[model samples]
Target: MADSEQREGMHYLESLPRRWVTLYIPLLLFLFFLLFPFYWMGLTAFKPNAELLSTEDNPFWVVAPTLEHFKKLFIDTSYPSWMWNTIIISVVSTFLSLAASVFAAYAIERLRFKGSHQIGLAIFLAYLVPPSILFIPLATMIFHLGIFDTRWALILTYPTFLIPFCTWLLMGYFRSIPFELEECALIDGATRWQILTRIVLPLAVPGLISAGIFAFTLSWNEFIYALTFVSASENKTVPVGVITELVEGDVYHWGSLMAGALVGSLPVAIMYSFFVEYYVAGMTGAVKE
Candidate 1:
């Protein structure tokens, strides 16, 4: 009877105040940290230059929001072109990386070849090597290939980083699938290519979405390579275009800068909203394996 009472006491729910301290407060703080930047960007985007410059008005809330910054962003600047370039680069790079990663990861995980584990580890390590260092040699190659200052530079270069990470991610997810499934396909006289396309690819949709999302996000936000390889205003991605085109010398266009950022972030936000389930599932499966 005493042990039963002790067990009940141990398993009892916490009081509201204790729960607030242990869970609710920390969750609220995390949400604030994560969401405050977006809120600030939206607030800054709509505020008039007078309100932005003046100190009297409450910075948290905009009293008189205007479309002037957005107008300038869309009309006065080459934002549409930047948006287009970003989309094209991100899409092409993501697809290319996913395609390559599918094959590489399948081979590493399924082929059961010698040193496959070592090779997989090496690929992930390659991803850890910062792009800051790789860009120098990459820039020279881009120059030689005569793709410098062009969209192709970004499209081609993005896969260099994207593939390794995607391959690593897909490798983990692939390992989770039972090998017996592949064995049955092999016994049924399915060719490796046929098995890959018909069996493996179909089962790995969530992993593919997760890897694609990651590759797309990286390509979209990549600034250093975009800045170095593409000098032309029209070819620049959103990140580079906004910073280079909006600010001149000592002056900064905070309103327009925020507008560009808010607009630039929408696609990624929409993507996450749509595929968040698959992303979580893929990561869970990968980690479990």
Candidate 2:
């Protein structure tokens, strides 16, 4: 039945012209829009300053490509330190958020406590609160703790936003899991920790991956918090550091800026490319549940 349905769908676009107008053309246009930024950045990163400013050369294509921008970004700037700071903060925050989210999700979904539904709704609502508002109070707290202008500020404050969303995403996925399994384990005198470790966690790997990816990406790209919290050039994350350090008064290092952006985006892009399948499944499963 499915094969026949697929064949019927294919029949509508069987002709070359029909397929071109209905499928290939639109797909090509979408791909172009999606990938154009990366292409532009890559070209800009390799182009020399002269070609970049010259109207004589084609803007879309490179005339003389040079590695000087990359060299400057690496050798003359604190980009490496910024990158290391981003990695450490993102990874540590992601781990912390996921840990808290797991417990929160499991409790709300499986504990059968009073106001569980309300609590779950509240958690999701917390996620909807804008970071712009929360950052003010967070900044004060970080300053009071004497952790301002340090990587610890970002690592600690990031979970404030990350936990709520991760919890919400995980709650839905946890709901998709059968309650009967936990009930069976309970009858066998298994502890909650045991059941979680030996059963639920094993089954929830996709959900965990999805949550981890979301948390990591958010932490990596986070700018306002990183900027407001950390003032030191070496402590800034990629997003904040690239913008603050590369642009001076009425002058922008376009080549190095593009190089930093291009390089900065690679980690998240590679992560998505690898885990896209699981990410989709986790999102769909959670939403359906």
Best candidate per TM-score, number? 2
- Show where candidate 2 strays beyond 4 Å: 1-10, 282-289
> TM-score of the candidate numbered 2?
0.93
How well does each candidate superpose onto the true structure, as a TM-score? 0.91, 0.93
Assess candidate 2 and give its lDDT. 0.89
Candidate 1 ranges beyond 4 A from true positions: 1-12, 281-289
TM-score of 1: 0.91
Candidate 1's error at 79, in angstroms? Answer: 0.6
**Winning candidate number (lDDT):** 1
Give the per-residue lDDT of model 2 (tens digit) for 223-257: 88998998988888899989999998889999999
Clashes of each: 0, 0
